[model samples]
Target chain A: MTEIDWKLSQDIQLLRLVTVGSVDDGKSTLIGRLLVDTKGAFEDQLLSVRRKRGPAKESEIDLAMLTDGLAAEREQGITIDVAYRYFATPKRKFIMADCPGHEQYTRNMVTGASTANAAIILVDARNGVMPQTKRHSHILSLLQIPHLIVAINKMDLVDYSEEVFKGIRDELGAFCAKQGVHDLITIPISALKGDMVTVRGDNMNWYDGPTLLEVLESLEVTDHIDEKPFRFPVQLVNRPQTPDLPDYRGYMGQIVSGTIRPGEEVIALPSMQRSTVREIVTYDGNLEEAFAPQSITLTLNDEIDISRGDMIVKPDQMPKKEREFSANVCWIGDEPLSVRKKYWIKQTSNLGKVMVSGIEFKTDIHTLDRVSTSELAMNEIGRVSFKLQKPMFFDSYAENRATGSFILIDTFSYNTVGAGMIV
Target chain B: MSKRKLTQLQALEAESIHIIREVVGTFRNPVMLYSIGKDSSVMLHLARKAFYPAPLPFPLLHVDTGYKFPEMYEFRDWFAKEIGAELIVHRNEKAIAQGMNPQEYGVARCCGALKTQALLDALEEGGYDAAFGGARRDEERSRAKERVFSIRDEFGQWDPKNQRPELWNIYNGQIHEGESVRVFPLSNWTEMDIWLYIRQENIPIVPLYYAKERWVIERGSMLIPFYEGMEDQLREGEKPTKVMCRFRTLGCIPCTGAVRSSATTLDEIVAEAAAARRSERETRLIDHGSNTMEDKKKEGYF
Candidate 1:
């Protein structure tokens, strides 16, 4: 925020990251070390810790307490909810959302990993891989968070042996590769000892690679925005009909995908008004052009009645505008996904009256396979069909996460009951 | 302004202007909450730009706690007079007259009665359907989860976990009767962004933000100043020491402290803020307590 180009100088890259493992796997400890070393913690918070927790006993500080802030969470010594933390290196910025690993909170883990770019599955070198690890890996594959890092933590307890590290890493890597998560990075680390985290440790002579921070900083954000279809949902209508500037109505929204420029032919959705791009407008005024996720205002040559909840797109790249569609969903609420349940279906500004057409299938998290089912329960991940009252256009979730991604809103309650990636 | 396409600043300005207009069109009887803070000041300026050729459509509500800086009042009066807005000033005179100093009744309780409660009481009394606030997301962790049309219960409480899922840009302001919503047009703005926008737009704000000479006493890590009716509570080991100080964030004197600074100008303040060793919330004593705002929000304390 200090720099006008902070978003650019530290280019905004949405990285979907997941930290998965069983309890005492030192997942929280690793994240805490990253934040502290990166200078993300404030002095007051540091001061509070120094005054209360005292010095770290011949070791590094407890970084886990910084994130697990709740009294219940601290008392239980575990993370309950998916807490999102924002940090940036000179090269890129990362949005790390850590998920809870309790078996009861498996739904929370799926919720956390649904939008991730990479998966950090912590493995205790001594304990090796457990049933929960397989479940986590299965969920990661099903959700399609591309990258994977198998961090074999607590290597010190294993006498910092490379043989133990290699064995655990090899087994998990083989399992994940079989599950279609081919892109994997294996690292042996001691979260408690600050080994291969922010700083390299002396014990790991067998490893020759970047530290965890280096790997995270260097990991490509995967510029997939270029391939997704163009979708821009208008947020505001800026028509300052003052004497100084009249006849200047612009439709504003961040581009969900694809590109836009002056003179490019576009269509206003629902209304289906075909118009030429008169100009590209922004809060800063007009841009020569704009791309996906960059909020811009488009002024058309025609005076079409486009309001909020309306979308704009390329004339040819018009999404699949249909009344019914198949989707892969993660049910978040206690309320089950039943047939004929009317709720506010929010797509990219094309709000539709949605109901469960039929429960097509639900995925078994342990197998990464689909199971034919009629309904979804709390924390249940499944594939289902939805019926909307009106036709709203969108691409598949695999094709475009921006336009394809949506949440089910309970009409009266207004709770986000389920998260969906359109098929 | 002559048919010139929008710049990034102008684009942000335009989007904010549109948000202001929607608040007017969507709500029954809308009002803008004027705190005279820099954020509120920017909101007011944008409101003026939003509905130019016509005065601000909504009446500006300033829930005065009577513990404000004198300069803020002066600026408020002058601006209100110049803008010709239907300015409504509400205060809980009973609480003030009862000598319920923040020191005695606790900061949270005192703020609850004077500021938060008074504001809620005023909104209910005025029947303001929607009130525009200058809250930004980057201000605090809790604030980071805030949406544009943040719906509050009839008692003016915010439920973080229970908020409506706001997607794209459209906001849902619809609520049951007796329940009002908070409209934050500057939800994306950061502290540095506010200063930069102020510098870019040349918006006028109170002089207290800049370094200035005034009788002050230092306590804890902050410079406790000599303001009217405000008493200093120094512990045994503490002593009153004066140093050049200015406010990064401002509220009631007891809660909002002056940080030690030499940056007297806006540019200097921005630079100082960039190089500062502490978070802006560190100076805000209300946030010092782990879940102070969260608790207040839960208890109909707003």
Candidate 2:
């Protein structure tokens, strides 16, 4: 064992990556190889994996069993849902979501890609760019994942041929270009053979780019969250009616985007009341200024009927406050979406009844074509318009992910039936 | 815009606070599960921070199996008072009265009746619509696949195959009556993150986490501490030996194992944790059989 370097460990940045491909494209295996090659898997965890599904040789282990944690998944010999796995090198800590690639599980892919800084869409070298690969890439682009990594897997099966790699790269690259993928890095590797993943094997000498892990470690996360306009959705109001602090009325929320400082004039939505930020409070004393992704309490200069489900933002940067809105929704409920049904929509600490006023069209997962459809079944993506019971404030999902996305809950079952992104 | 950015730890802290507040805002009633462990300590800290000036809006629930270490109980009470939050300690009195000991009925039966069933009973008693736990994805294999806001059916059973698709930071807290959701604010936090956060926040934890001279007897590579009334459970020729040990995870007194360590401070513990070869739950003895945690979770074990 080596001595642990606390400085490096504590200061390492976090990179969230998602793996997406067809069912046999080996997303789980790629993730498993990453964990094993990086020495992130624990001895006991590996031991259990080997005991259940490994080969007779101690050195050789079944990688897929490490994930596919559910019994049904193992029984079926495929991943059905998204599994989050963590690994790290000296420079960065990585959180990878191994998403299922079956066409019916598009919801899982979207869920996994929702928070990813980068997405690795595997392309089987033997098959080239399949429809599922394009579908995953399209969804990743739709979700605005900054980085796109095209891992042309199974190079060893193709005898590490450059022609095979180039063919798939150009095809997939052209398709991704259509999707507006700005940061695209395509690599050739064999996840099963452990080539060009963490280490560049001798077979891939023709490829000069960095390894997959290297790209993941070095890719700068282009997050402009703090630079965006300040939007705070009050989740709770803090008031200690105790004798010690009688006049304290603080608005608690996480700054979804941009920065905030004391004395900054802001307007509260729904109520349209304006006030200045008196103080930015946190557990570790008062911060001089707070930025996006920081959960803090704010004391206003004047308390003018502010409560939960209210948005506070700078007057100059106002969000669209309306009762009618349109969004792209991925229907995930077991029951098909009906236009007559009224669903409960929860977005940014606000919940209200919403009716599906119209269904513009549904995106065909296989061809990426928009077809007119009146109803959306399980795992179908569609452009839908809604009429809310009350006016709510929101931005387009592309502008601010935190304030722009909402989940539709079933009225009777209360299950999260659909996920919508404000258009 | 100022060039200020949140560090990884700070980002994780902010994410957890946001999750805690979401539960409080969405659910009619919510409670935090306090297990008197390091993760629970960090979770309680985040909860307090979520609503700083107003104190905690929810109470803390501890599902006691009556097999916890005395030090854990003391620290649990002390910390509950320190935070000025309501602490609800519930135990399966029927199972205890039935003399359901780990040695007699086996680890699975004992834990099922005591810990698992007690948690369900406690949730029903409080009528809590949502319960917050400190379960992290990095702890176990099955846990890695669980959602941040995991829903349980009317029978308090988890259907891993049929889970809601969680997207973005927006969690769906909607649940029918008799059905509840388990919110793990620390879902993304790993074991290393937990220890590091403990050190960064200077969160006080049970002293048993620190190494000290204690009487212990080895059982299949595990250092079983010598708690009161353990003499009868010891084998015929086995004798307790004094060794410097500390617990990596805290649970029932009879099941939780102690590791040989000299770490007594947060810094040393963090360093030790970083260099640990095996997983954290390896010290938990009751985690026997394959996918035991998954089985227990399906049966409503938090």
TM-score for each of the candidates: 0.83, 0.97
- Where model 2 places Cα greater than 4 Å from the true spot, the runs are A1-3, A6-8, A338-341
Compute the DockQ of candidate 2.
Answer: 0.72
Candidate 1 per-residue lDDT over residues B113-202, each given as its tens digit: 887779888998999879898877545544544567778887788775445544324445556788888888986555655776788778
Off by over 4 Å in 1: A1-24, A50-61, A103-119, A124-146, A222-228, A238-248, B1-62, B74-90, B123-152, B158-206, B228-242, B289-291, B300-302
lDDT of 2 by residue, B42-93 (tens): 9999998898877788899999999999999999999899878899999999
Model 2 residue B292 lDDT score? 85
Which structure among the candidates has the greatest lDDT?
Answer: 2
Looking at model 1, residue B218 earns an lDDT score of: 66
Q: State the local distance difference test value for candidate 2.
A: 0.88
Candidate whose TM-score is highest: 2
> lDDT tens digits, residues A1-423, model 1?
443245323123335467888877877777777766765566665565555476655254567766664444666788765555655555555656666677666655765676577879998888999878887787677666767788889989999998998899788888887767777888888888888987888999789978887788777665557456678877557666767667778676667677788998889888899989998754345678676555566789989878877888888888878888988777866688887777777665545688788887776765656788767887677888888888877888777776777778777766667777787
True-vs-predicted CA distance for residue A96, candidate 1, Å: 3.3
